[model samples]
Target: MSSSIEDRLRDAMAARAQAVQDEGPPPPLPLPRRSFLVLHARWTAPIAVAAAIVTLVAGVAVAVRDGVPQRPVAVAPAAALTPPFYVAAIVTDHTVVSKTVTATTSTRAPLGVYDSRTGRRTAELPVLVDSQVAGLGDGRTFFLAGRERKDAPLRFHRITLTPDGKIGGMFALPRRDDLRTETLDALAASPDGLKLAYSVNTRKPGRKGEVRVLDVVAEKVRRWHTDRPGFVDEVTWAGNARTLVFSWQRVEQEIGRETRLLDTSAASRDLLSAKPVTGRTTFFAARPGGSSFLTQEGGGKGIPPLVEFSTTTGQPLRRRIMREWFSPQAFDSSGRVLLGIVRGGGLARLDGERLTLIEMPELPQGERVYLETVW
Candidate 1:
């Protein structure tokens, strides 16, 4: 019976092999007790399908664990990524003379006389009112203008100091009625100290205000006629004291200002109007011997925070976005600029490209530093 059974099984296996050979080559035999033991089963097609599904699942899991993505990261806007700048030391101080007080007012406001070389306060003068003052390069003489009395005329005075911090001279200016209805805005002295520029504003009942310029050396006065009424913000001597660069704006509830460059020798006024595209602009220092003036441009979006332009050509020289409240106070002989940067309660100096902290030494417990011209 066993032989009969074995013969039957062998004959069945032989018949299967013959059928497979008739079709093509016989299928490869997978060896048992090896890595491919399960592949030898008759259900090899189903086992291969299961293995392919498992491999795909494992690949997806690895990608998720490693946090790999199919796309790239986006970039941010340039303007939003820009950093802020702080001021360092101002190089305008070339000398410091002495540390002395010649006079002190009842209000305790000492008139400080500074020597640019030594960076010292040489003398101080006491005056009645808080006056608008201008210093002469000689470091001894000063020009002050303010209201004389409650309803009286505006008075101009010349105060001079001796070498020993003594009051050398104090004289009143010539009485003038033209300045009665107007306010004094700016005063600039010529480099030679022989000439001075005075800007005054006058108010009319029903018309725009008028601004006039007086040349003390030439003893001449000229009125600037504009479509808008405004005050002269600044007056600066250009190349040779013959040309003057000034800035003014129409006074309204809304601040729209314009800066102009005037040539007293030409007898024709050259106007550079800052369009109302931006907000109110404050004129700072004008570059010596150049037609360009530095201005702080405020208001509107996408506009630079600071800009320097040629008042004659209306060409922009340099534009940068630095701080909100700051101005170009002075420039050294080497062309380095001294900037006054106001942050919170204190002011600092931005010298060239460095930031230097400043402390006011006059007031009691008052360490606030402001802007002043050195030389």
Candidate 2:
């Protein structure tokens, strides 16, 4: 019996591979190895009492819903689709900016940009030592964190470059020793380009980690707590300039683990709470208008699939089972998401319904792409 099953599985895989080759690169194989075997076992089960009970229940539910056969609704392709965003290495005379590094390297990461109409690559900005980069639409700015040494002192710099690659202006961040370094996690520019939001991490023994938001425009900051031990995963800027949507984890002695959302607005100075039914949500990328986000629901083995969710409604938007671990890298202005599926020692996009497996291009060997926003 086992031999027969193995033969069938092999045949099925061969057919799929042939289909994909004929059509271009295929999507990741539909099922992982272990999942395919478990599904096969269930299919081979004898028709018995338990199966009858399940069938009866399903039939009743369908029948009671008015005789109209129920079917899952297909989502429409995103309206006003934006051009695909591309990753490129900036050619620069600066030595530090030219060298490339792996995705894991925090220092000297590559800068990513997206144009408005044509969605063309405008200009690649050079990243300096200890410099942090963030985008507000077409304009890209780099921030330099201050150093601890007495002679060097803590300082910050902002590099503004024109679309044609001309240097525009430079500024500095306020310097202070008391300011905690670990507290800083991510920096984001509001869609309008008037304000900036910084995700700061704070850790205290016996208490949950805290991520605070600092309003760069107003020069004010507020602190919030999360039960997650490390830093908050990512800080996403909503379409509306006033609101910021963020995720944090909470550990419960009785319940095991829980994840929650904090919708904060600068106008009201309030943080509203919304709970997602999915477990241990890892936020990847948000839609252009910030109405929704692409998220991964489960981890390890036997978990819920990766999915997209509407931030406003807290509803399950779409789902597909990824046979292996993957992280959402970015979302283009259109609703298409770029995911980094782990294979070997590198990462590449397992394009969904449209594009096929696209190997990320090689930059200077060590260089990495630090994605901020797709738009």
Worst window of 10 by summed lDDT in candidate 2? 86-95
Clashes of each: 16, 7
**Candidate 1, run of 10 with poorest lDDT:** 81-90
TM-score, one value per model: 0.52, 0.49
Displacement of residue 251 (Cα, Å) in model 2 is 8.3
The local lDDT score (0 to 100) that residue 38 gets in candidate 1 is 55
lDDT of 1 by residue, 1-375 (tens): 366775665566555545434433322232345545555454545445445444434333333333442222234332221101111121121233457634322222434554332334555544423245554434456666667653556566677776653557978766433455555656765554445566665556323434454555565566655565566666766545566666666577345556556666665442333222223456566555565667677566643467876655656767777745565554332234443445443444555445554443332332333334332
Per-model CA lDDT versus the true structure: 0.50, 0.47
Measured by TM-score, the strongest candidate is: 1
The positional error of residue 204 in candidate 2, measured at the CA in angstroms, is 5.7
TM-score, candidate 1, is 0.52
